[model samples]
Target: MEEYAREPCPWRIVDDCGGAFTMGAIGGGVFQSVKGFRNAPVVSLKDSLLGFRHRLKGSANAVRLRAPQIGGSFAVWGGLFSTIDCGLVRIRGKEDPWNSITSGAMTGAVLAARSGPLAMVGSAMMGGILLALIEGFGILLTRYTTALEPRLALATYSSPDPLAPGHLQVHAR
Candidate 1:
């Protein structure tokens, strides 16, 4: 029997953290830039050019200062979540969305524990729900694609020319 190659836990955690950090950094940069531009003061028409320059500068500064903070937060959250997920998989001896949802909830609760009991509960619920929705969507997408695959293959092999006589043209709506 050929054994399936799998990434070790440490490397998987590292990969998850690095990817999450990069995603967070880029997303934070764009969000902060837009927010800064929107909050920038609009001066009189006479100084519109100055206003524009101010907005540009403000946006750049926001990106420079806030992006790293947001990125670090995301990295921490991701690392903790991934670690929990790996641990759950090891304990349960299986892999599934339950692990992700549980991990997300635990990570959120852990991160928010310093805030208060209410905050921890709220964060845990929010995290679990969010992960559940994401996993549900993924499952739906996979099922839809799998269901379509045979039909798509049939369509492709049925006829070379759509306009030919007796050609069954499949229209996907």
Candidate 2:
């Protein structure tokens, strides 16, 4: 909805998918270890990824099925957060750091809705604060620039045409 054009290159999608997978694996490992899962940590992660549908390979075959769900949750979170950010920006007159925090918190609350009221509130607060800090830093670094001289908005060029019929020539600026 933003009027400003997005970059033609789409590294954001790559970042989201790759980052989600990494986080999923880490989350799976930590949770499995903490909960005392019997399978090898790697198996536990793989089993979760498999959704416990097909036969489990290695120690993870019997690992509790939650990996796939968690990964999907992350993917959803990334997508929903992006949508919310765009929506908020479009609804508002302009983009600001506030929108970043607002969208982040809203996304977090929705993701944690199933956990409980407390979780929703906690997640929302954390998400909002985290985004505020990160976005604020980014705004400072990119939006405000120190310059040696003001950038040229317009330049005038007036010169004789290289190819001309006669002494009478075209001039442009």
Which segments of model 1 are wrong by more than 4 Å? 1-6, 42-45, 157-173
Off by over 4 Å in 2: 1-70, 143-173
TM-score attained by model 1: 0.85
Candidates in order have lDDT scores of 0.88, 0.65
TM-score winner: 1
For model 1, what is the C-alpha lDDT against the true structure?
0.88
RMSD of each candidate relative to the true structure: 3.9, 12.4
What global local distance difference test value does model 2 have?
0.65
Candidate 1 on 1-173: residue-level lDDT in tens?
23335577788789888888998999999999999888877765688889899899889989999999999989999899999999998999988889999999999999999999999999999999999999899889878988888778655335778688767756554
- Candidate 2 lDDT over 133-161, as tens digits, reads 99888767665553411443223334466
- How much is the lDDT of residue 127 in candidate 2? 94
